[model samples]
Target: MDWKDAIIAVFAILLLLSIATTYLVYHQQQQTIEVQEAIIEEFISARHIHIETTDSAEPPAFVDRYGRVSSSIVNIIAIRSDTGLGEIGRVLIEITEGDGDVLVNTEPFIKPLVQYSVREAVEVAANFTGTNVSKSDITVSFEINGTVIGGPSAGAAIAVAIIAAMEGEQVRHDVAITGTIEEGGYIGQVAGVFEKAVAAEKGEITIFLVPCGQKQAIYYERQTEEIEIFGFTFTLAYYTPREVDLGEYMAGKMDVIEVATIGEAV
Candidate 1:
């Protein structure tokens, strides 16, 4: 072959070799990336899903509004020096589908640790109903009209709300409840049953439920008298020695049902 032709042939061979080398490099890189992706997916699949406690301070668990339930709190009776006997306060509870933790947020209310423990007890009850509470986060909120909700009186009402939210049931608006919830799902006696019952009736609640055996309630009557001292009037308050049994007193006003457990209350 001629020298010029020979040189041209060598150049063509080199060009072909370069093209093949480039193709192989590109193909090998693509394969490496594919293998890396598969390994990553396998690792992800093998990793177990674990639940970590939420952010700083263990903020309350939260649920979405996709499903919701609510319950009415019985009114509590409070005695004021100026006023003798009257229905004073009530509490309202709302629940929704949670995303495994439970957060009970109270607005202008009370119950402290009693309410928290009550929520935990309710969780147990809800789980017994086949609800995957761990897979859900529940939020319980209490609404009151500038009234403080002290003690564990909201146990029964809160339980019903949690169950209704998980099961998507309806809670009667005219029904009110008060009682302390124990860890075993049994309810305990609460204070101020008469006041709570009276408040429920005042709110037009038709069904009022209290803890069983809490048939007697003590309404502490107080007498206040104003006395003039150095141009300023002073008032003194004292409790009266009168205690009344609530079983009969409540019988005539509303449908009072005595429940021993959350299952019975529901």
Candidate 2:
């Protein structure tokens, strides 16, 4: 081939490579973002979600690459007790509405990630709740386990929901968190609190939010490990599991308050 033609071919090849590289790099980054967001969204929604639209002088901007957004919401899980006979009762979580303008949308490109369900509390309660030798005499209280990573941790999200309901403020995405909330409203430690904290730091979160009471321990542990708190503010508060009413929590009528005990939330 002529020298001129050969030079042109090389340039064309170089241009194609540049375009392909850019596409691949962007695609990979997008895939990573999608994966992480899915993990967070699934865990939150798997509990209960409350989306609320508030009348504000100025609405909040969209938090992500998604479209212009306004609104805030809480993801929650509800548990019921028939007779205070055991550890917990039946637990149910649904996505409802919350206060504020948090954008809600569906993406057609993302696939749902497969997650493990928390081992039912019933399996753990067989030893605690049997009344008589007869099978019918046995009663069981439903409980949820969220500390087991890769499994559902609606328990933690439920605590946040209760907190939001009491405080009357929507928990936004700006804060990253993870934890397990017990029936007593105590923020129980989880397997990945530190890892999740690191992840949030990597995301440039200004505030590291988690189930309350875990802050001192997490902060202390991070300090010993030489991990920086990343200039993020940490707020920890209890979620009233029992006294916190899901119905009212969803309605946006509840006050933004801290829950002292899970028993009080119900």
Candidate 3:
């Protein structure tokens, strides 16, 4: 081969090696990202709760409709750390896809339509509750943008907030409650009940409400004080009181009312 031709061949080989090295580095980075995503997915799946989308027939289902509004109450569920924070982390929200009419409707653009609806629901619920703002002014407005929400666990607190807004009463900024609001207005129980209760106590909450099943968490929290133990199981337990027991607690200190509907919030 000629001298110039040999030099050209050497340059070509070096260029190919550089390209190969770049490709390998890029591939490794992609794999790292995928592994991190899988880890997050696993964690979220284990901690997440599945909430079914509301029936399509429920008009004014999104919070913005202007009709004389009725309310649903529910208990909040899921897990929390003992660090006295109320932020929900790494939540996985999925929409119901069983009905083709709902999600897979044949219209050319309806897939985006259904997807938008689901996104709206997730945004309203997750964004609103994730913050420290009062639930009273946290109005969840919806549009034709196609949104739905589930996990009815936040219904009770939402109902209480809504009732306060409707009646022109003030909700204490220092207090928080958890429970599912059923269509009939009964508050249901939730998991991680103790963690949330303990958080409320640590925050010096003036009042906290929970379903009957979780009353024990409160009873124990009221009696606890800071201890210098290295590591121990934090037990938040309480005895279930009789139906009238809550009424007595309500008279003084902090009120824990068990009402079947938003109408009974006072």
Candidate 4:
């Protein structure tokens, strides 16, 4: 081939290479931006940040991450005896670094079942969740306002919060989770599914975590309506077990994520 023809072919190949390189670079940048946005979104959603939205208003203050949750509170959904309906119960926790002795409030006010659950939570978080807390100098204290909340169901949330607080990791604030943390680190399922869902919704929780197999269930509710009549009044009520997807229940409201282990949860 002539030198001129050969040089033209080389230039064409070079031009094609340059175009491919430019396209690849642009694609990679887009992917990087997407990943960064996902991280920020995860961080923000985890904390359930509440902010006002307006065209003229500034965005809500957001920190990259958070450290050990102090007074890290989680809600427990329970059935109210009086109303025979679901209600939201609160659990408040405070953890402090101490001198190697894990202290928990086993007070008389605290139910015996909850006391056991709390201790189990401390042990699981310390040993399983990759948290390196000085067991010799840490204290865990919690206050329970509702009696209906019992069993190891709260173990997962309690353990993770303690670990997060000690490790200075951020616990998603907008999410509420329910499950019992097994001694072996398996997240065990708990009862009160219907009531818990109701309670979670009432609390305005955006994400609700449940154990595997517990993802799909039935929730029954009864409503009473009064009708005025010509000479009297009629009251009508109905109840049924509505089939629903745990993640898309409540009229496809909040997210109900099913987690099987501590790793998935964290």
Worst 10 residues of 4 by lDDT: 56-65
Please give the range of 10 consecutive residues that has the lowest summed lDDT in model 3.
88-97
Model 3 segments more than 4 A misplaced: 1-78, 81-138, 141-151, 217-260
lDDT of 2 at 160: 45
| Number of colliding residue pairs in model 1 | 7
What overall lDDT, based on C-alpha atoms, would model 2 receive against the true structure? 0.34
Kindly report the root-mean-square deviation of model 4 from the true structure over all alpha carbons.
Answer: 24.5
Model 2: per-residue Cα lDDT over 141-222, one tens digit each: 1233321122233344444442343233466544433444444344444433433444444444445444444443221221
- Write down the lDDT of every candidate, Cα atoms only: 0.60, 0.34, 0.42, 0.62
Best by TM-score: 1
RMSD of each: 30.2, 21.2, 18.7, 24.5
Please list the residue runs of candidate 1 whose C-alpha ends up more than 4 Å from where it truly belongs after superposition.
1-99, 109-111, 223-237
Give candidate 3's TM-score: 0.35
Q: TM-score winner between 3 and 4, please give it.
A: 4
Candidate 3 C-alpha error for residue 170, in Å? 1.9
Flag the better candidate by lDDT, 3 or 4. Answer: 4
lDDT digits (tens) for residues 120-234 of candidate 1 = 5555556546544544555555555555555456666666666665554557777777786776578788777777777777778777877987656666777999987445576
Worst 10 residues of 1 by lDDT: 76-85
| TM-score, structure 2 vs. true | 0.28
Candidate numbers sorted by TM-score from highest down: 1, 4, 3, 2
Candidate with the larger lDDT of 2 and 4: 4
Clashes within 3 Å, all models in order: 7, 34, 16, 15
What is the Å distance of residue 55 in model 2 from its true position? Answer: 31
